[model samples]
Target: MFKNIKNDLPASIVVFFVALPLCLGIALASGAPLFSGVIAGIVGGVVVGGLSGSKLGVSGPAAGLAAIVLTAIATLGSYENFLVAVVLGGIIQIIFGFLKAGVIGYYFPSSVIKGMLTGIGIIIILKQIPNFFGYDEESAWDLEFFEIDGGNTFSELIKMFSNINPGAALIGFLSLAIILFWDIVLSKKAKIFKVIQGPFIAVVAGIIFFTLTLGNETLSIASKHMVSVPIPEDLSSFVGQFSFPNFSVIFQHEVWIVAFTIALVASLETLLSVEACDKLDPDKNVTPTNRELLAQGTGNIISGLIGGLPITQVIVRSSANVQSGGKTKLSTILHGLLLLISVILIPTLLNKIPLAVLASILLVVGYKLAKPALFKQMYKLGWKQFVPFIVTVVGIVFTDLLSGIGLGLLVGIVVILLKSYQNSHFLHIEDNSNGKHKIKMTLAEEVTFFNKGAILKELDNLPSDSYLQIDLIKTRYLDNDIIEILEDFLYKAKERNIDIKLISKRGTVENPESFINFFKEKPKSNISLS
Candidate 1:
């Protein structure tokens, strides 16, 4: 970890810039105290980052949990009581880690996971459009398709055009240009460009632009469009920012319910992010899911104790870290430290940076996540993989993150079932020298009820006066429904004057009186025809 400090340090600064607005924006969106968001960011970075087995995955207050936090806080009656739920939720997540529930992350299809990354990328670009134009109605961190301020995604974009601030638009375009040039042209020219990230340059330019345009009526950006970090007046007031949970609420049934809800949701979101981060990792490093859950549980416990929103491994910050050249957990830890120090020492200076500039940085991140090449790549993989991938992207764009993933997963499952049904048997039909049809049906390795329909259709469609051979040489397990189908087909075979040949390890039977009786007479587990 220490060996990559040169790369990690610079990457951490970029992640720090990305995380700051997000921390504040998510908190504002959740209706939680502004400081609580910063606290979550601090704990997510330092504590979770320290314990995590992942080298590149970063943790923070997630926008995915904003709606849940808002509802829980209001339902719990007070923020202090809500803290109790958050602590308990952490405990539950630790239990989940111990129980090895992390395997759930592996069950998600690759298509859905990739869709999630792309979906989030598209959301980031869409949400940041308003900020980029200096339309400050919504928080820069809000990722939902529908705004909490009572507008939809497209509506906000429409409004931003009419309400664009020339100062912000100019700075945003300039910052974006600098970022593009640094990444595409300057970075390739020398090693120094790699060490000094484009985002940092963009931020500095935003601040300078803000300062120079202070008095110009046509170009000056408003305070509303600038970064806002809560500045403590003095030592006592700083301490006042921290809030303790009400332990008495632990006995309340509702508290436990809320705790379980947060644990389940936070654990799921964290696992999804862990998978996505590993996918984004240039080295393709696999993260230990169970350990990640434990780390997140610990972070949430600490965050809640100090009045913060629940934490999860966030894809936004993690992707930013990877894209900015983060090499290890050191980048994650350093970013947390920056969040802590900046809020304490230079918050006033931090607030001077324009949100439009930050939006420009995120726009690049978004574009990378949802690049056009990825869509074409998925399409080339065939519809089985492509449908889920496309559905996940569309669902996420129209709905929220989790809902989109669920929809995609559901589609993927249906696809799997359809394939299973189609592949359950191999049917080969040949015309015998006597002009009668010779039909041979080979059962799949494992035949379940899903295959019953297809098997029945083939049996029913067999031409009359034909010889049919039912082969079960390689079958390991046969469902009862398929056996019943064959049994019922025996009568039909006799009615059509069709001859039947049943082949199994038990030996061949020609025109068996009953299919079920033959199988019951010699029930061998490893029955296979030679």
Candidate 2:
């Protein structure tokens, strides 16, 4: 795991910078104690990363669960009670692994996964716009409904234009500029700059700028615009901030509902991340989805017990992990350790960092995830893939993350079923010298219940007195429903005095007892018509 330490260290720094604000943002959004977010980040990186089989995937307190966490807390009457749900959620996920439920990840279409990533990329960009401009409303964390401040995301943007903080906006732009230059210019000049990473540089600049402004009382950056983790004067004070579960609610129905919600949502997010991360991975490694579920279940249980929000393998963090040169799980592990140590030993320094700087960092991360090239590549893959991809992107942009993907997946499955029904079986007719429409019904290689509608429709439309040739030479298995459809069609043909020829390896019998006995007496398993 440590073999790629040289390459991994730079990646770890990138992930650390990327994860810092999200940890805070998600916690802030979920209405959890700020320190709990950091704890989750630490546990995600150190504990989860250590056990996860995925090489490039990063785990953290997911923004996807922020709304759920908030509702759970409100519904349960306390955050401590909510923590019990989280712990239980983790245990449920662990059971999911043992039950071999992780294969659920495999069923997601690749197009949907790409759409999700692209959609998330768009959300990240949108969400960070406020933070980037230094419009740090405490309500920004509530990303779902119109804010308690009487504005949705769009309204907030309009408000940002009117209430922009010159100091925060200036710092954010400058940090972004630094990051852009570091990636585009300075990094090319030397190996050292490349190793240092652009996000790290931007963060350092943010801190220095904030520190320098502190001395000048005439000009200052606001406290809300700075990193907001609590700064404890001593170890005991920091430890005191940790909130544990109130296991007293263990038997409550509401607790189970919250637990299931966390488990289901966290698992879904993890699966989606795994799929998207695989697409982003340069190595094209196929992560074992079941193992990933188990890993996540274990991580969530640990995170929940320790007062952290539910954990999931997050694409934003993982994508940043990949783009930053993280080559192994070690970078992820190191990143968590850093979060733990930084919060405990260096909260003072962390508190000094500016949120605008981290926003700048995320701004870059979001851009990378939703690059113009990604859109172009999807468009190039053709409309079959592109339509769903765009639907997903648009869905996410218009609706929420899961809803958008659900829309896209719905479209994708419709397309699949259409293709399947169209390909099920068909009758091709040719004129024969016997003054009849010589009909040949060619069956699909494998017919299932889904093909029944198409088969019945086609057979019912056959013309009277037509010489029909029923062919099953290429068919491997004819489902029972389809077999009945054919039998009924033969009866109809008899009533119309239409000549019917049955063709199969078994025999050339025109009318046989039911569809099954007709094909059964031929041979076992590999039945074929001579």
Candidate 3:
């Protein structure tokens, strides 16, 4: 893991910068103590990163869980009571790992996954716009499309334009330009540029810019517009920050309910992030989902014990790690250690860094995830892939991450059903010299309940007084629902005076008395043709 220390060290510093504001912002958004978010970040990096089977995935207090944490904390009556739920949620996640529920992550369609990545990217860019312009209406870390402060995504942007702080804007734009220049021009020109990332330089430049513009009223960035970490005044105050769960809350039914909800949501978010991280990994390394679940569960348990919000594999930090040239879990572990050390020692220094600089760094990350070229590529794959992909992206941008994915998954399923309906069977018609009609219906290789409707429609539409042949010669498996449909169609064929022939791997039957009985009686494989 330490073989590429040069790469991991710089990537860790970049991820640490990206994660710090987010930890604080998410903590503020969740209505929990600011220190709690940092605690989760620390555990997510050190503990989860060490235990996880992923090379580049980074775990932390996820923005996706902020709303849930807010509601649970309020509903539970106290933050300490909420801690009980967090611990129980971790146990449940461990159970999920044991049950091999990790396989569920593999079922998500590739189009939807890509859409999720793009959607999240778009959201990051949109959310960071407010920060970039020095509009401090919401926390710099907030990524929700609908703001907790009672505004939607676009409305906040409109409001931000009117409330821009010149100092912050100047720092943000200049920092962004520096980052872009370093990434596009300098990095390719020199090897040293790769070792020291643009984000790291941007953060240092932002601090210097903030320091130089201190006394100018119009240009000076406010303290609120910069990174804020809870600085402990002394040793006792630092110890006071840690809170323990109330064991009495363990017996509360509501606690269990909240625990289950957190476990389910966190596990899902973690699994999705694992898939996304794997997709983003330059080496194309596959993460073990079950191990990730176990790692997350353990992290959440430790986090909750120390008065932290639930932890999950967060895509933002993971994506940043991948983009910053992180090669192993060392970057993840180092980032956590940096978060721990920064809050304890150099917190005052960290607080001086402008939020605009971090926003600029994220802007680049967001652009990479939602590049326009990806849209063109998806479009070329045809509507079957493009529709779900676009829907997922739009849904995520308009709503939230999970909701958008659900909508996209629904669309993907519908496309599958439509294709199944159309391909259930092939129909051939022949008109003989005597004016009699002959029709042949061939079943697909595998016919299930989804194919029943199409098969039924074709059988009912068969012309009267015509010869009909039902062919299942190539079918390897046939659902019972389809068998029932064929059985019921026999009465209709008799009513229409149509001669029907049943062809299967078994022998040809002029009119099988019973579709079920024929399959049961003739267990041996046979080829039948009319």
Could you give the C-alpha RMSD of every candidate to the true structure, in order shown? 1.9, 2.9, 2.6
- On the 0 to 100 scale, the lDDT of residue 56 in model 2 is 94
Clashing pairs in 2: 504-529, 505-528, 505-529, 505-530, 506-529
> Model 3: per-residue lDDT, tens digit, 144-168?
6777778888888888878999999
TM-score ranking, best first:
1, 3, 2
Which residue pairs overlap in candidate 3's backbone? 505-526
Q: Can you write out model 1's per-residue Cα lDDT over 1-530, one digit (the tens) per residue?
A: 79999899999999999999999999998889989999999999999999999999989999989999899899999999999999999999999999999999999999999999999999999989889999953555777788777888988888887899999999999999999999999999999999999999999999999999998999999898999898899989989999899998799999999999999989999999999999999899999999999999999999999999899999999999999999999999999999999999999999899999999999999999999999999999999999999999999998998999999999999998999889999999876758678989888888888888888888888889898988887887777677778888888888997888887666677856755677665444333333
List ranges where model 2 is wrong by over 4 Å: 137-150, 215-219, 495-497, 512-530
What's the TM for model 3? 0.95
Q: How well does candidate 2 match the true structure in TM-score terms?
A: 0.92
- Distance (Å) between predicted and true CA of 377, model 3? 1.3
Give the candidate number with the greatest TM-score: 1
Candidate 1 has a TM-score of 0.97
lDDT of candidate 2 over 365-472, digit per residue (tens): 788878899888988988888888999888877667778878999999988888788899777888766767788988888887788888888777878778878888
